[model samples]
Structure formats: C-alpha cells, structure tokens
Target: MMESQQEPKVTIPPLIPLEYSNRMMLKTILECGDDQIGLFGKTVVVGGWVKSSKEVKREPVAAALKPPTAAEAFPPSPGRKELSCVEVVQSRIPFFKKIIRVFGVSSDSYPGVREKFEPVPKPPPPPPSKFFLQISDASSISSLMVVIDSAVVPVSAGHVLPTGTCILAQGVLEKSSSHGKQTIELKVEKILHIGTVEPDTYPLSRKRLPLDSLRDYPHIRPRTTTVASITRICDTLDFAAHTFLHNHGFLHVQVPIITTIDSEGFSEKFQVTTSKKWGLGSGSDADVRHETVKAEQHIEARDKSKLGTGVKPEVKEDFFGRQSYLSVSGRLHLESYACALGNVYSFGPRFRAEKTGSIKQVAEMWVVEVEIAFSQLEDSMKCAEDCFKFLCKWILDHCPHDMKFVTKRIDKTIVHRLEYMMSISYERISYREAVDILRKVTDKTFETKLRWGVPLTAEHLSYLADDHYKRPVIIYDYPKAVKPFYVRLNDDGKTVAAFDMVVPKMGTVITGSQSEERLDMLSARMKEFDLSRDQYEWYQDLRKHGTVKHSGFRLGFDLMVLLMTTGLTDVRDVVPFPRTHGKANN
Candidate 1:
C-alpha cells in the first residue's frame, strides 16, 4: 500500500527570452548608450505610425558596393551596412504602435526593413463610420502616439474630433533613414474604438489656433496643444511662485474676495450687496413678503425706462447692514495678516469695474499679493527679483515640452529672454531717474509726454523694460502725491518708498512699497489723501495694538502669464471667462 502511493506529474512552460519580449527589448534599447548603435549594419525595431505612405517600383541595381568616402570614413565606422529607401514617420501621431517587431540592418539606418508587415490582433467591431480613430498606447516608455485616418477626413477647422477620445490601432513600425529615426505606420489591420465619445476633447493636434478664435470657446481651448501647453506653464509658474515664498517661510494666506475697501483706490470695483434688488435677500416669511413688495415696486418703476438701464431705485434699508465690493486687490488685507503672521501671501481673483480700453487691463483677474512684516521696500524688491527668477527656472525645468513649444511658436525669444532676465541683476533707480529717462525719449511713438509728478505711462514703462534697462527694472521712490496713502513717506517728504517692477512686454507686473507703520505719519497721510478715518478704523487698530514696519507687493496673475509665455496680447487672453467692461460673456 505504501509503495502504491505516487505523486502527480508536473510540467513547466519554458521562459520567454528577454530579447523577444517587447517590454524587455524596449528597456534594453532605452538603456543602450547613445551612438552605441551604428548608422548601418544594425537591426532595429521602432513603433510609430505612417505619417504618409507611398509605393514605388524601381529596377534593382546589380552594381557592386563602393568604398566609403573620406567624409563618411573620417568618423571610425561601427561595422554596419546602410539600408536603402529611407522613410519618414511623424511622431505627432498618438498611440502609434502598441506592439511591433522590426528586423533591419543598421539600427540607425532608415527604411532598413526590406519588407514591412504588421501582426494583426483580433479587434472589436468598428465604431460608427462617423467615429474617428485616435490611438494612444505606451509600449514601454511613457511616449504615446496617435494615428487618425486622416485620409478618410482631413482634420480641419470645425471638423476635428473633440479631445479626450481613446482609440486602438494596429500598425507596422520601421526606422526612417531619411529622417534618421524610427517610425510606425499603421497599415491599420483593424481600428478598435475602445471608449465612448466625449463632447469636448483634444490633446495634441495641428498648429495653435489664434487667440481671437479661441475666445469663442474658453472651455474647450485648453484641449488644444497651445492652450494646454500654456495652461501647464502657467500652472508651473504659479507653483514656483508659491514655492519660492513658502520655502522662505512665508505663510500662504487666502484673503477674502468680498471686502469693504479697495486696496488699490485708483480702480473702480464691482459692488457686492445682499439687498433684494442686488440678489442676496433671504429672511423670515414676513420679511421676504415685505422685500418682494418693495422689489416689485422698484421693478415697475425701473421698467418704465429703457430696458438695458443699469440703475436701480435706491432702497433706504441697508443690505447686510454694510456696503461691500469685490476686492480689487488683497494687499490691504494681506498687510494685516502679515503683521499678525510675520510674512504672508494671498493668491486669488480680484475684480475691477473700470472700462479700460487699453490692451493692458482686464476686469477680473487673479493676483499674487505678498506682505512681509518688518521688511522695507528694498527687501521686497529683492524678494520680487528672486521670485521672478525662480519662476523662469522652474518653468524651463519642469515644463520643458510646453516651454519649448511656446518658445518656438508664441515667442521665438521667450526662453532666451527669460534666461537673460533671470541671469542679469535687476536695475534699481528712483522715480525721478525714470522720469528723466522718459523725458529723453521724445519720439512721435510716445503716446504721452513724461512729467516729473505724473504717474508713469505704459509707454514709459515699456521704454524702461525694452530700451533703457534691457531687463526687469525696479523703479522706486515715487512722488508721494501720485502714490497711495499706505506707502511710507521717504526722508525727502516729496517721495514715497514705492516701486513698480516693469518687464519687457508687460509693464508694472508688480507694484509694492513699504507701509507707513508709524501711526502719526499714517494718520497724517490718510488725512492728506482725503480718506475717511472711519473706513480704516480696523486697519488703524493694528497700529494701536502692535504695528511693525512691513512691505508688500501685488502682482497681476494675468500679467505674469503674458510675461512668462509671451503669447497673450492682453490680460483678458490669459484669464478664463474674462469679465472686461462691456463684455461679461461668462
């Protein structure tokens, strides 16, 4: 009985060789040193799509091979034979080849494969004929290629597929000797539609559409190569800005968008209210009924006039018992936070109601407001320079592809320009010096003549950025009469410790200054500016309790985008759903 006991037989399958597996082979290829593969006499396999395909017949030559020329032989040749009939394959295609096997002479030689064929895989039924194929599969690396049946319907304006469609394709891959690279040509044995259609979708496609055309479709523009690339760059810049501050121990503060005061008193603000007429009335049933009656009466009176009239009948009762406006800037609030929390920054949308026809302005845009306690204008200027340099370097390093595309298409000198700006130390000069420089440039191109006390115009700033400094210039110590009341008065009494950082294309990207921390001086300045003391009681309370010398700056986020990518013509082009005066499409 013991001898009758027997074990079941087991069979083990043979292991697949690493060289035959696609992933293993791809790893090997990636690990291979550059130039290790000869230009000829090497067998290489590449996976991509057929950008274009052609068939031609020629008589096969029977002549013997000739000796290499001196030009070709100067570089000691790695022993390999060159292949004939080089082909080109565009890498822009998506999901070129999920899997491919190419055997050819000379890994560097193109059209090396004497014959090309793709192994067909069983694929699902084709989608509707209307459905276009968009392939995106990774062989081993993260590279994805997309191949569309361009012959069926050439991708053009209004006919391109919405972005975000997934597709599968079968194709042949070969090395292109003419182009000096490898490519995949989708013989397209079978195209499989693996996903449902998305309404608005796109990844990389043809050239960037104009900003004017994209304005009509803000939500979908991001799907395009240009917009996507810019978005990614903007995101990186934002990250760099925050990181530059955070790494230096600055607290990230989220300031309120709705506030009672305008930090930049020069610009008009969008009013926010809780009154029934302004759309934020809610209370008890009885109060609601009363509000409804008042609203109806007001509406009846208003309807008696023009249909598009913006005025509303004045109500005696206060809404929310206080007046508020969409903050034009968060600098004031951030100053208080900075005094309390050391150094702080606020990043958020700021709204303005000014009808600026100038190309430099937008009604609603994001801003980066930074305030540092115990810091002066000089310290703030240094911080700004460091922040700008950090942003440029971060974008170049983190968003190489996007930056490259933007530099090539949007602005040819963007990278070089930004690099030069970062490498060179910023020039610092007094406002008086800036005024003198502007006075010297008396050309017809200048829109306005420069005056000593007048606020510097965009033309003047442009001259400083483009001509005078050749880089970012920090112009400080402005005339106190033209500056905000918050700015600290300099020893000269006629000037304030304020500065504006002007870049080549964008002027006044950042404006900041040391605050008047001395209560007596601030009170006197507030009186001189004709500002109501009651309006800033809380702000003054800081001085009453514990006020420290501080300096801060406000950077228009849209302006930063324009300066970074150099594509956007106006601030509106950079912001999504822009709310410029006379145009509130969102």
Candidate 2:
C-alpha cells in the first residue's frame, strides 16, 4: 500500500483584531463583560438580519488644552474653562483618560495639556450618515449601532444599512453610559453585507405578516420571526426526542419511504407508478393498458349483443411489475426491527392521500414511531409518557429565547401548558372509561355523538384532554374494530391494546398500540380487515418464529410543534410546505 501525503492547513487572516474576533454569540455577550470588565475592550464579530435602521447625527470630539500655569492650576479657578476641563478629566482617574496627540506634545507631559488654541478647520459633512440597526440571528438578538463615520461602507446613495439586510459586522464591545444604564453595544467598524433584501419588495416584514399570506410564500417565510422561532422550536424538539430515545437505549433506524405493503392497509395512500401516456412515449405501459381496456370493452359490448364470447384482457406491467406507494407510516417496518433489536425507533416523513379540509390535515407530515420487543402495552405507554415529558422539559431548559418569543406572540399559556405537561402525571384510562366520561357530559354539545365502537373524533379527544382533565390524557384499549389490524386484540376480543395521548389545544398528538405477535391471530385480523394476505406475508413471518409480545407508538412530529405554538391552529402553518388537497406550489 502506498503512503498518503499530508495536506497543508489553510488559515484566513482576520479583518478585525484576533482578540475581539472570537465570534461570540449575542446571547453570551453579557456574560463575557458582566463580571470582568476586561472583555469590554475586545472587538467581536456579529452576523444577523437587520431588524430596523435609523439615521443619527454625529458629534465631534472635545479639543484638549495645554497644562495650566502654576498660579492657574493651584487655585483651581472655577471660572477658567481649561481649569474646569482638567478637573473633569481628573475625575475619570485611573480607570479612563482621553489620549490627545498635539503637534508638539512630549511623552512625559501632564495629563491635561494646552497649546495655543488654533481653531482647526472642520471636515466636510460625512457622505450620508449610517444608522443604528436592530439585528437578530434567531438564536439571540441584539442591537448594533453602525455609524457610517469611518471606513464603514455606504449601502446606497443616501441611506445607511437597510432593514432585512443580512450582514456580518466586526466591531468593538463598549458599555453605554448615555441613558443612565450601563448597557452593552457594538460599535461596528467593518461590515460585510452578505445578503441584501429590498425592504419594500421583501416577503417577510419586521411586523407580523398574516399567517395566510405567509403560507402562500412558503420558501421565504422561514426568514420571518414567527416562522423562524417555530423552526428553532422544531429543531430543538428533534434533538430532544433523539436525545431522550438514545439515552433510554433505543436504537434509531431508517425505514423505506416507498413500499408495496400499506402499513395501515388502507386505500388512503399516494400511489407510485411509472406508467406514462403522453410524456414518456406512445407505446408506454399506460398506452398498452388503455388499449387493452378499450379492446375488452368492445368485446364485452359484442358479447352483450349476442355476437361473440368476451374475455377480459390481462393488464400490462409497469416499472415495478406491481403497485407501489409512498409509506403512510413506518410502524410496520419498525415492527420488524423491534422483533430483533429489542427496542427501536424511526423518525421521518409519512404521506397520506385523504382529501381532508380540516385545519389539522396535511398530505405530508413527520412521524416519530417507536417499537420495543418483549414489552407489553403498559410498558409502551410508560416509555411514551416519559419521552413526552422529557421533550417538554428539554425545550424549556434549552430553548428559552425562542420559547419566550413564542409565549409572547403565539400563546400566552404555552409555558404553562409545557409546565403542566412536564410536572403533572398524565391521566390514563381504558376505552370503556373514556366513553363513560364522555357520556356523563350532558351539558356540553358534541358535533359527533360519543359512543362505543366508533372512532374517537378530534373534538371528543380535545374535550377529554383539555376541558375535562385540563391536562394530558392517555386513553388505551380502543375498540379493535376501529383501530388498525396490527394492533393486538385483547383477551376479551372486543378491544385492542391501543392508546392515544391527547393534550390541550391539540388532540391525538401520539398514537400507539401493542402489536400482535401471534401469527394466526394477525393473519385472521388481516383477513377480517380485507387486507391482502400476500402483501403482508413478511409481516406475519415476524410472529411465526420466536415472536415476543412487542408494543410501539407514533407521535405526529408536526402536531407536536403546532401544539407548542398556540398561534398555529392549522397544521399547514407548522410544516415547511402546506401540501394540502389542492395546493402543491414549489
């Protein structure tokens, strides 16, 4: 084997001093200067989108004078302007002193020096002044007053930095004593406008844009404060979920997005086909299928008229030779892993083809599905409960800045909701108990009547979790007839070991159930549900050999975000693209 050569390392020189170019985040700026004032002298670089900008006048520095005569200095003449200036300069003491460089000043001169007062000619007015820009990088936002006095580049003909411009600024950290408070600020020196947005034509504004309008411009909406904050919350949730799962000894797995078998075994799936009529060619699979169908229809008409015997023609094959679809859930694939891995989970996008018009519906969404082998229904529920609580507490501790923005703008009760989710124990009850609670509520009206064997509606779930309990509620043991075929049938044979975790404002954020491990029972359920046995033969094989009782659940990742952000009533608002019944804009 040949030996590999080492590559040389490349380094970029700093435009600002190395000490200040530590690239400190805005959130930590206070901590850097709070205790030790030494950090205040260093220069730092900050990058963010400009929130606002305003022009301000600049004042010239005060001129220095020569040291006063012995008689003038000893008496400390209050009437003498130079004497008063010296006293004011002396008050600053050892902490701070102005450095004045006169034409003939010596190095050992006294602190206050006076030369013949020659009125220096004032420089011409600075080419259109710069303004203070309030900037935020989404994580931690701070204001930067970038004056266009020195080498600061001019943005345009007359204006300074415009709002919404993304710039990287190098500046000195200084404490402001102007407004009686010693607040920190960045005196920007060199600015690199990484991105410039024309304020008038920009889709995102400093002011809150209407949520509907924002949905129309999905590509650019992330730049807005509302969407940006929600995106951060989602990112944090992803981290929290993975951290919680990994910490609890759950192996993360990736499942296929396209498959032949429907996890739910329902017709509500986005069909994937390679058949094309007008696009690919004339003699394509689609054309072949169409001609065969036409010929069969003609033959059938002739046979109906007693002219000939008719037979249906076989359909031609497509690319896959059989029908395929985008996965509606990863639960079935996750089940295969759980049977061997003991504990496993998968997090990714899932698709549905329902023409749902409700605010909660979307064609594409994210699901965090977990499966654990040798675990019963109760064990699965406990793990799910702990995971949910852990995520709630994790976001509160890690994403304080974004959560504060959400609480103030989106929902005032968001923090309280998260706290309640974390602090209180969730209420757990069987399907029979849940129906009884709904039946006793005679005072309130329900759009759909509450009863046994019927699938639970959103309103019913919300009322139980939000209004009735005022906290999260996990309802288990759903009627087998209403749930999917994979759910384990109870001993009584009436209900399945299924559960749903519903919370205030958003119902049914999570759904899980114990999977059937008995081959015969699972096959019987598949036949009962009219699902093809041939398609699920692999699924049944898991139960055929050494099948251990396993349970799992899926949390709708988008719904979780929507619940945390109260302002987003529609599920479309939380996702990157609102892929609904009609709209599919790029």
Candidate 3:
C-alpha cells in the first residue's frame, strides 16, 4: 500500500551554502597570506579584473641536436601504450601534465634515432605553456595571481587579457614553484565567466591614473586603487554616523528634501519645479492641448491678478504650492521634531547653489543635522565632538584594510591624524581668541583683511587647525549680526552662541548653535533680518506654544569623509556622483 502512494510533486533544489554560492572575494584568500599551505588543495571560485598577464615560455621538450620527429607524435594504434609528447603537442595541449612513456615500439627520443633518419624542421618554440595573470577585485591593494594552462582550457597564442577584463574561475589553491613569487597561487581548472576588455578604449588600462583624470570615467573609476579605497572609507563613515547617533538614543527623523523655508536664510538654492515641464519631451496633440490649457489658465489668472484682484487663489500651481526649493539644510524641519520628540537628528542630501569654486564645495552634499532639546551651546558642541570621534574610531576599527591601502597611496599622515583626534581632546577657543592668533601670525598674510565682524575664510580656519593648533579647534561666539537669525544671541547682545569645528586638512566640518527659544527674541531677530513674518509664522509657533532651549549642529558628511582620507583635498573625490557647477557627468 505504501509503495503505491505518489511522492510529493515539488522537489527542493540543491541548496548552496552562502560562502560557496558566489565567488570568494580575493581579500579572503589574500588575507590568508602568500603561503597558504594550510589551505592548499582547497577548491574555490574567485573573480576579479585582470590587472596584468604574461605568458611564460619554457624549454622545449626535445634537445638542440635534432628536431622533434613525427613518429614522436604517438605510437601506432596497434602498439601504442600512451599519448607521446609529440602527439600531445600536435593535439594542441599547452601543458604536459605527465611524462610521455610508451610501452610499444616508438620512435626513439634520443639523438641517435634522429641520426638514423632525415632531420625534420623543428617547430618554433612551443607556445607559452602557462599564462600568468595578476588580478584584483578592488577588495584590497594586493592582487591574486592565477596560473592557467591551455591544456585545461585552451586559448590561442595571441589571446591576451587586457586590463579591466573581469573573469570568474574555479580553481584549486596550491603552493607555487617559483622561488620569489607568491608562495601560493590559484591553478585555474575551469573558467566560469569572462568579461573581456578592449585595450584600445579601456580608460583604466594604465597602472596608475591621476585622480583628476578619473573624473572623466566615473562609471569605471571605482576599479582604481585610490578611488576604491576612498569609496569604502566613505561607506564606513556613513554607517558609523548612523550607528553612533542610534547608540546615543537619538531619534532619526527624515526631513523633507523639498521645502518652502530656506533653512540657510540667504544661501542660493535650486528651485524645485514640477516634472510636467513643457517643450522638453514630445507628446500627442491631446497632451499638448492639455498642457497649453494649463499654461493659459495660469497666465490668465496672473493677468487677472495684476489688474483687480479681490482675493488670492487658494493654492499655487507649483508642485508644493507657492515657491519650493531643494533644501539647503534640514535643520529647520528637524528642529520641529526635536521640539516635540526630544533628541532628534536627520542625515540626508542637501543642495546648495553658491557659485564658489572651492574644491571642497559641491552643488549637492550630505549633512548630518542634529537637534537636542533643552541643550545649550556646550551640550551641542559636546554631542558633535563625540559624534566625530566615534566616527573616526569606527572607520579605524572596521576599515583597517582600506585605511592602510589609502595611507600607503594617498596620504601617509592620515592614520596618525585620525589617531590623534581619537586620543587627544579637542581644543576649544572663543572667536575672539582665534582672531588674535590669526593677527599674531606673521608667517601667512590674511586674504579677508582680519576683522572681528567678518566671517572666517577657509585660509583662516586651515591656519588655525593645520598650522597653529595642529588639531581640531572649535571657534565659538560669532557676531550675531553675521550669523543666521535662529542662533541665540549671547548675553552681550552683539555675538551669538555659535561654533565651528575645524580640522587639519579639512576646514570647518561642523557648525553648531544654541537656538533662540524665546518667542519674542526670535521674532525680533527674524524681523531684523528682513524675513517675511507670514512665511516663518509656523516656525515661530514652535516658540509660542511650548519652547525649550534647543541646540543642534550640522556636520558636512562629505567633509567628514575628506577628513578621514587625508589624501583627498576635494569633496568630489569622496562623492561617487559629484554634482558641481556645470558638471554632473554621472
């Protein structure tokens, strides 16, 4: 009865363990060291881009006195014991796996046998028996050496692997016979995948491409050592920031990317427009008529308003109603959440349209905006400092491999600078004190003409961090008139309780301030700054209903990455798709 029962219709497919399902990273085997004798004879599938390849020619099987004979090709079928070298060679075998030995009568390999017959033409030195390839997957600076035999996977003599040719192959790791080469190498038995490259047009074919030149080929530049290393470092920094914020009991609130209020007050911003742009994409006659009617209606309404408008239209035609823009900062929206929810933070993209040509400046950037309720300037500074330190330590601990790679190639002092920041306490000084140091310096001349009310330039901040203090310097108490309207005015009434943290090689990375919690004072400041009361009435409501002293900071994410990588001078180098003035070549 049991034998008559039918088996289940569905059969489970063979399960592949995660570690073996995909090709092993070169880093895994490389970290095992040059001599991985313990791992020898183990089979692994690995993939990487071809960094270089060379064909090694060996000594021909026959001696110099006579050429290889046709009889050496093999013994007659009747008496043949095994395939001879001549036969294997003629069979297009690139490697001699075993010694040729025949039991039956065969042509003598000895010179005397050749003397018994007319000499035959010696085949030009046999095609290189082995192709040596060095490939890297950008996992590490060290590349894995792969040995391929044409006998196992036949390739023509002219076949060459150009740089950037990606390949995946299954092979066995074994001890290398070469004296000075890597102690262990992959002996490829089968090639699973191959992405050949055209040497003529492959952009990254050179051994070392300048960082500037890499901008032209952003799509493929991650294969480069410096760019790849920087990319990994940036990735770690991003995660570290989130982890640090989460560990500290801070709530991450994603603010609107598009907003009506200009968070930075006077900074230029990208106007957010509806995607229904006219005259860009082709459309049917009905679609055109629909768009034309909408435009006509808007123009007619504007014309009607110009002459005799009694009441305003309920909602504007813009995407968000009225004017909207890509947010320059998330602080304003995030502050609302902090006031209601205690400690809150936001980290995301921010767009700026200032026409400055500084290397570190980009049209689009990332910022970590933090707002702490009932906190003062001191608390804000401490929170930012801790966050920065935690991020540096995180990268140092989790990204040692990438750090070492960048240190060796880009900036040698980067590691020490990071260690310094982690161990030593940051230096804190008032804006007045920083100005005194700048004026006292006779070595470098000032470009802005040093003044108490003027905003500090990159040169000034760099001088304080890189040269004078030789560490991170937090400058606080800037002139209230020059700062944003929200920064709390100090007791003196002339300066606001604002601060900026400047680091060596990376000028001002963090900006923090104690926000004005008093409704009366905030409204006055906003009015004095010529801000429209109607536009910022909602912001004022935070103070009117229930306001507590709130402090926060905006840390430039790209600048933090630049700080971690000592070699990079520009934010563009760290950002994968840098959007700058007139250039966004993705």
* Model 3: CA > 4 A from native: 1-21, 33-35, 58-128, 156-160, 179-181, 275-315
**Model 1 agreement with the true structure over 270-374: per-residue lDDT tens digits:** 887656564535688788778888887887876677457765445334564466789887888888888888989989988878777877677778888899998
Top TM-score: which candidate number? 3
Q: After superposition, how far is residue 529 of candidate 3 from its true place, in Å?
A: 2.8
For residue 243, give model 2's deviation from the true position in Å.
1.0
Clashing pairs in 3: 73-87
Candidate order (lDDT): 3, 2, 1
Which stretches in model 2 have alpha-carbon errors above 4 Å? 1-24, 30-38, 57-128, 141-145, 150-160, 177-182, 278-316, 565-567
Q: Which candidate model has the greater lDDT, 2 or 3?
A: 3
Show where candidate 1 strays beyond 4 Å.
Answer: 1-143, 146-208, 278-319, 442-445
lDDT (10s digit) by residue, model 2, range 304-402:
766354443222356676778899989999988888888999999999999989788799999899999888999989998998889889989987877
List TM-scores for all candidates, in order: 0.66, 0.76, 0.80
Which residue pairs show collisions in model 2?
20-43, 65-113, 65-114, 66-113, 66-114, 66-115, 67-113, 67-114
Model 1 lDDT at residue 97: 33
In the range 1-586, model 3's lDDT, one tens digit per residue, is 4678786454222223236458777777776553355667878888888888887766666655556555653335675578655555545422221222343433444434332333466556455578888888887767888888886777653444677877788899877767755677899999887887788899987878788888878899898878878877888888898899889889999999988887757779998776343433358878788887787787677768866756544347665777888999888888899998999999899999887798888999999999999899999999989998898889889888888877887789888888888888899999889888899999778778998888988889989998988999999999987788999988998999999999888888899999999888898898888888888889999998888999999999888887655468877777788888899866
- Shift in Å, residue 267, candidate 3: 0.8
